[model samples]
Target: MNKKIGLWDLVFMNVSALFGIRWIAKSTASSFGLGLGAIPAWFIFAFIFFVPASLICAELASTYPRDGGLYEWVKEAYGEKSGFMVSWLNWTSKLFWYSSFLTFLMVNVAYVLGKPELAGNKIFVLVCSLVIFWVLSAISTKGMSFAKIFTNIGALGSTVPTILLIAMAFIAVIAFGYKPASTYTVSTLMPKLNMDSLVAISAVMFGLSGAETTANFVTEMDKPEVTFPKAIMISAALVAGLYVLGSIAITMIVPTDQITASEGVLVALDQVAVALGIGHWFIRIVAFGIALSVFGAIILYIASPIKMLFGSVKKGVFSDSFTKVNDHNIPVKAVYLQAIIVSAILLITTLLPSVDAIYNVLVTMTALTALFPYVLLFKSYIKLRKTRPNEKRPYEMSKNNGKAIAIANMVLIVCIIGIVCSAAPVMPSLGENIWYEVQMIGGGLIVIFAGLLIWKRFTKRTGFKESS
Candidate 1:
């Protein structure tokens, strides 16, 4: 039997999984691009959209503590086919997300190299991005032990720089008496519920999301029912605090209009460095840390989804090929297959007119893909509560079943509204149209359907036999 991870390990892993280095940079950059008012909107959405989602997950994770996480929970509640679809959508989204992170890593590398224009050079970014992706892929293929090391290192490496930068910004503000470009008024602080604001909020929500992994980690946890919910609450609180304070720090140092989607965090840090009489070398170090953070996220993107793929295969939902493993207990074939898809995405991105254009599409698509799993998970939670009322659950949200279901439903409704409204075509002249937005959502649906079709065909041909 595999050794169960202790309570502390589970907590740390859950926190690491939820709060990656890229999140800080991405959230900060998003605020700059969306406007300062957008920050509060994200806060609202996070509390309403994310908190309920976490609660739903807590109930599900405790009820169905298993290795496959979402795949197992959905399968138990719905069916194997639906579960496979959820996992497939998630795994597929990570492929494109990994490509986006690679772009982010390359952009930061250019910033550190003092060749900002190189980030826009598709060939350079693509080649360098592939190298980074493959290197991480190699490490991932060694085993989960190796991947866990990278996850811990990457989480710390990326998080320290963000916290340090936020601290430095505060010191700069106090020591130099720097004032923000805009006042911190109620109007500036609140997020508008308008179409454009809502869309931007959706993008930010994607950056903030990722608590669903708690279900996967529960089986490894020492006392999952008790410890897991505490960890989820702590992680959510910490992430919310970091995002709000980080955005304020960035706004204090740089004008919102000047924030670019790709390099916004680095740009803010650069300003802080100059203000504090810090040299270019020091700023470059921070940029390097930022790059590493994105790199770490890319590494997780490479490693996390293989388990889902393998689990689906074991359940006879996917082909036997995905179940193949190497001496190191790594899913080498799945890693390579995902890498190929990610590489293809990088190539397709190069053909796009601009990095921002490609990024917008990718970000939107990633959000849409992630949302599908949430919908299924929430539905599963409601069903399981009613159908399996007497099942042992380490953690129960409330003594009253009605209250728990109502809270879960509220969270689902808020997230659904946020996601649907954000997908509408409303962003200013970045060529965002109904067709493009529909393509993003439609593409995700197609991928999910395709997975279902493949699973049906595979099972029909094989007589639903589980492979050794």
Candidate 2:
């Protein structure tokens, strides 16, 4: 028998995949420019978006605990063509998403070296990104056993620092009497219903995602039908709770004006340490922790999606060579291919006019592309429920088709909203630049079309006719 993944390991794996503290900074920094309002916004999105998506994903994963995850479920419900597209979007979105993670890692590295200004130096950021990407890529090819070490460390990096920050925020406000930059009134907690707030929803949605990605590894667990749902529920609660408290902690220290998404966590750490009368060196230690957390998440993400996508090669969807696996059962060639594509993207985006602009665009594009798969995922869940009502599920979201379908529709509605808002500019500066909108929306369209073209070529080679 293959060695089974432990429940704690699975929980940490999901946490490392889904919970990056940089998002706390990102959300508090941009939370619809609402400051304290972002706190309640996290709760709102978690309820409307994260909770339902988690439940639906858990049901789908438990019912079909297979290797390819959403690819298998989607192909079962829709067809091979739809499954391939969903897998493609999931894989491609990671390429853009890697730029954001790489940027976060390097920014914290700059803070660690006591040269925070270097965070904005494009050349510095680019070199560090390349080195880190290649290093993680090489490590990933060694397989999940090696990757899990970082993920377990990442779970510590995420939870311990976040809890420390939250505790420090309380001390700073309650003991030291430092005035918060934002208020904590009822109206202030409520998010404003505006274009800015709409865009902020996209960020929250992005943060709450990766539950589906966890499905990709269900087959690695012992009694996955039981283990997968438990791990997901535990990690989901932990991640969502941390995000809310973590955002509150960030806003308590870092002034809204000084907070940039890329560097907000460092700013919060620096300010809180000073406010608490701790030496500045504390910030550097925390910065190193944040980097480890992001690195762990990146390595796991680096391997999961490619494993799912390349699994299609078994069905003859691609050349036989793409199915080549290392001694560790990882698809080495596909991983290298993903690395080259991301490296090229990282290199190209560095030449763009503004690093900030490029970062926001990459994030928005990732959010937009990421949602397309979830849209299909929710659809697959509902369809599978109706069509396979008798399918044995260790954890069913609801036995009643009406309840399951209603929750599935709720997820779909949020995905549509997220997709629409994600295509708009999140910052005032980018809002003024029409090309930001062009790049955000146009880039999403181009990626979707690229998937369609790939599907067409696959069909031509295999003589498989996709349903119109």
Q: Each candidate: what lDDT?
A: 0.69, 0.77
Per-residue lDDT of candidate 2, residues 367-442 (tens digit):
7788889988998988888888788876677778888898899889988998998765554565344666766777
Candidate 2: regions farther than 4 A off: 1-14, 31-34, 138-144, 213-237, 326-332, 351-354, 390-394, 427-432, 466-468
Q: Which ten residues in a row are the worst by lDDT in model 2?
A: 27-36
What is the alpha-carbon lDDT of model 2 when measured against the actual structure?
Answer: 0.77
User: How big is the positional error of residue 16 in model 2, measured in Å on the Cα after superposition?
Assistant: 4.0
For candidate 2, the per-residue lDDT at 122 reads 88
Assess candidate 1 and give its lDDT.
0.69
- Cα-based lDDT at residue 438, candidate 2: 68
112-152, model 1: which lDDT tens digit per residue?
89877887777888899888888888888876563444566
Pairs that collide in candidate 1 are none
Model 2: residue 131 alpha-carbon error in angstroms:
3.2
Candidate that scores best on lDDT: 2
Estimated TM-score per prediction? 0.88, 0.88
